[model samples]
Target: MKKAISLLGWIGVIFTIIALVLTLLTTYHFTYVKYFNDYYTLQWSIFGTMMIWAANMMVFRTNFKNIVYPITCVIIACATMFFMYMKVY
Candidate 1:
């Protein structure tokens, strides 16, 4: 159970990296494949959910001094979502 949660958190990190790459590619009109129109939105949603889940798990499972990781996850999630909403390049 702990490993699964940790896996999800790492997966979320990888997804976030993918999202950043995709956004950068899109910005330069360098799309490799025609993604669905709502792909970015959907990706953002999943990214947010996974990261938040990881953060929740961390908050409940870890010591108070180790709170930084979860907080960082949440901040990254929110920042990415905000960029998605604003359609920033």
Candidate 2:
């Protein structure tokens, strides 16, 4: 059961990557969603957060790295989005 849960975490990570890629590839084509067009780059950073969000749902074995990984990802994602929001270019 622990292995299965671990597998779920990995699967979530894979799907998150896939979602981010697909979002990047098709974000320009989202003519139906005005918000998406208006928030193009903002959406990209959102995809990063979403990746971590999915990762946070993980229920893996009792390991430090396994636990910290998702939380750390979330923190990084939030920091990135925050910096991006600040228009740090």
- RMSD of each candidate relative to the true structure: 4.1, 5.8
Per residue, candidate 2 scores C-alpha lDDT tens digits across 12-63 of: 5675565555555556674343333334445454545555454544553266
What are the TM-scores, per candidate, against the unseen true structure? Answer: 0.55, 0.39
* Model 1 Cα lDDT, one tens digit per residue, 53-86: 7556684665677777667767767776777778
Off by more than 4 A, model 2: 30-89
Candidate 1 wrongly placed segments (more than 4 Å): 14-31, 36-46, 49-53, 56-61
Q: After superposition, how far is residue 49 of candidate 1 from its true place, in Å?
A: 7.8
**Every candidate's lDDT:** 0.64, 0.55
Ten-residue segment with the worst summed lDDT in candidate 2? 30-39
Residue 42 CA error for candidate 2 (Å)? Answer: 12
Instruction: Determine the C-alpha RMSD for candidate 2 after optimal superposition of all C-alphas.
Output: 5.8
